[model samples]
Target: MVSCKNVFLTLTLVVIASNQCECGVYSLIRDLLQWNVAGIPIIHKTVKWDFDPEVSQKRREQFFELHGYRAGKYLERIGLGIDGKQRERAYQHAIRDQGKLQGLSILQP
Candidate 1:
């Protein structure tokens, strides 16, 4: 027989632990943006923008479509997320790569 209180505690702990991963989506984005603003060069330490560069071209195309859609729809207020080339480059090391693949199949053709 499980107590309701215990169940609630377990669920709460699970959610907390899940969010405490080494690097979460929120914190990762924040750090990436910070690095972009600071002009620091990325060395693939924590954030990884492109998980797999070997994916099919069709999948690569989806990234392009979603990139545009998401920028206009969600990131319009965030200033189009982390700019690869820096929106202004106010710092010397601004516009870090942040583990993004230099090129993808979609860009080839």
Candidate 2:
């Protein structure tokens, strides 16, 4: 009793719906890893930084603030995301370690 055209339309709709569902799941997983594990958002565009330390530092902080750290405490407050302060401490520690390895005196903040 079903017409061929009706069957084809149903099949097309089902395929599209399934594809959208799959895409949503993939996006959720990707966001979890990016923001929660890496403490960084998805950078959609090319970002440039200045060679000057002060300018670079300001730019970096602004970037973090604008994109936000750990999805702005949504995941972080729930303890599911990486803590921004902890990430900063790790960064500072790495800088110190690098300075020691290179035998250079790195200025600390």
Question: Would you list the C-alpha lDDT of every candidate in the order shown?
Answer: 0.53, 0.60
List residue ranges in candidate 2 displaced over 4 A. Answer: 21-109
Task: Write model 1 residue lDDT over 6-74, tens digit each, in one string.
Answer: 975665555455565655654565455446644566555587486666677777578667756445533
**Highest lDDT: which candidate?**
2
lDDT digits (tens) for residues 7-76 of candidate 2: 7566555554565565765556555545665567545457886666578888778867765774553443
Q: Which 10 successive residues of model 1 have the least lDDT summed?
A: 90-99
Q: Would you list the clashing residue pairs of candidate 1?
A: 39-93, 39-94
Clashing pairs in 2: none
Report the error of model 2 at residue 58, Å.
63
